[model samples]
Target: MLTRDEALTLVKRHVSEENNLKHMIAVGAVMKELAARLGEDPVKWEVVGILHDIDFERCTGLTDHTLIARELLKGVVDDEVVGAIMAHNWENTGVALDTRMKKALVASDAVSGLIVAAALVMPSKKLAEVKPESLIKKYKSKEFARGASRERMVISAEFGVPLEEFLTAALEGMKKVADELGL
Candidate 1:
């Protein structure tokens, strides 16, 4: 498996936009936390999360998103990791959400955006100020964080984690890398 440091280097090489890089890091943090909670390999999950959007900036369109990732990460990571990465963009890639990691990636990817948006709206604009309850409230309001898909986030519950618990985990995970996210 590709190490987290190697994955970060790869992501930095591909994704130049600061916000896009932070988003990837945020999802990685959430994936690490989710993996630890679920008794999975934290490093592997984090690497998968970090590389999930490896081709985001270069992809020509939504349909081309994870498809390019499949090519970029061919031998660097395992097939399972590649599959989870592809599955994160399942709507366009048509990959099956067959594993817990895949499901968690979907939830982590979406909730990271929601959590970041919530912190940005705070008076201090910090992750420390953003609460899980606030995230849940924002999640309920479709007007808030329109890009953060509620449908995708609901996948956490499908994997046995309650919505609030998943939000809490995501909030905690992002908080760990608050400086990196500039939240």
Candidate 2:
């Protein structure tokens, strides 16, 4: 399995936008946390999270969102990792969410944006100040963090994680890297 350092290097090489990098890092953190809670390999899950959006800039639209990353990582990573990445974009990729890791990826991807968006609107603009209750409140408002799909976030249920618990876990995960996220 690829280490965090190597995965980060790959992410930096392919993704140049500042916010995009932060987004990927946020997802990576959440994935690592979720993996630990789910009794999976945190490192591998972190690598999958880090590399999931490596092709965002290169690929456009749902059909292509994960295609380039899939090709780029064809031989370097395991099929399961690639599948999880592709599975995150399953609506367009047509890949089945066959694994818990895949479901966690989909659940983690947009919820990170929701949590980050919540922090951005805070007076302190600090993740430390963002609470689970605040996330729950923000999640109820569709206007808040419009890009973050409520349906997608709710998919955490399929992973056997309560939506509240998943949000709390994701919030804590993002909090760990608040400095890197500049939140």
Candidate 3:
């Protein structure tokens, strides 16, 4: 398995956009929290989250997203990590959501965007200013963070976590790395 530092370095090599990098980091934080809650390996989940979008910048289309990442990460990370990455975009990549990690990855990926958007809209523009309740309120508004898929965010519930609890975990996770996210 790749260490977190090595995975981050590899991500930086592929992702040039600052927001994109921050998004990946935020997702990794959420994945770590989710893994802890579900009794999974936090380091492995975090690394998988960080490397999920390793081909985000190079991909030509939505369908090509994780497909390219599959090749980019081949032999560098374990099959489970790569499979979870591909499963996050399963609709496009045709990967099965056969594990809790894969389902959590999808929710984490979408929720990170919502949490960041919520923080940005706050008066202080800080992660500390955004609470889980506030996130739920923002989530109710379909117009808010439209890009953050509401459907995907609810996938956490499919794995036994309630929606609010999942959102809280995600917010707490992102709060731990607020400075890195520039939130």
Alpha carbon lDDT of each predicted model? 0.91, 0.92, 0.92
lDDT tens digits by residue: candidate 2, 49-134: 88999999899777798999989899989999999999998889999987899999998998998999999899999999999998
Global lDDT of model 1: 0.91
RMSD (CA, angstroms), candidate 2: 1.0
- Per-candidate clashes come to 0, 0, 0
| lDDT tens digits, residue span 1-183, model 3 | 888899999999999999899989999999999989989899999998898899999999897999999999988988998899999888888989988999999999999999989999999999999978889999989999999999999998898789999999999999999999887
TM-score of every candidate: 0.96, 0.97, 0.97
Q: Give RMSD to native, each candidate.
A: 1.0, 1.0, 0.9
- The candidate, 1 or 2, that scores higher on lDDT is 2
Q: Which ten residues in a row have the lowest lDDT in candidate 3?
A: 86-95
Clashing pairs in 2: none
Ranking by TM-score: 3, 2, 1
Judge candidate 1 at residue 157 and give its lDDT. 86
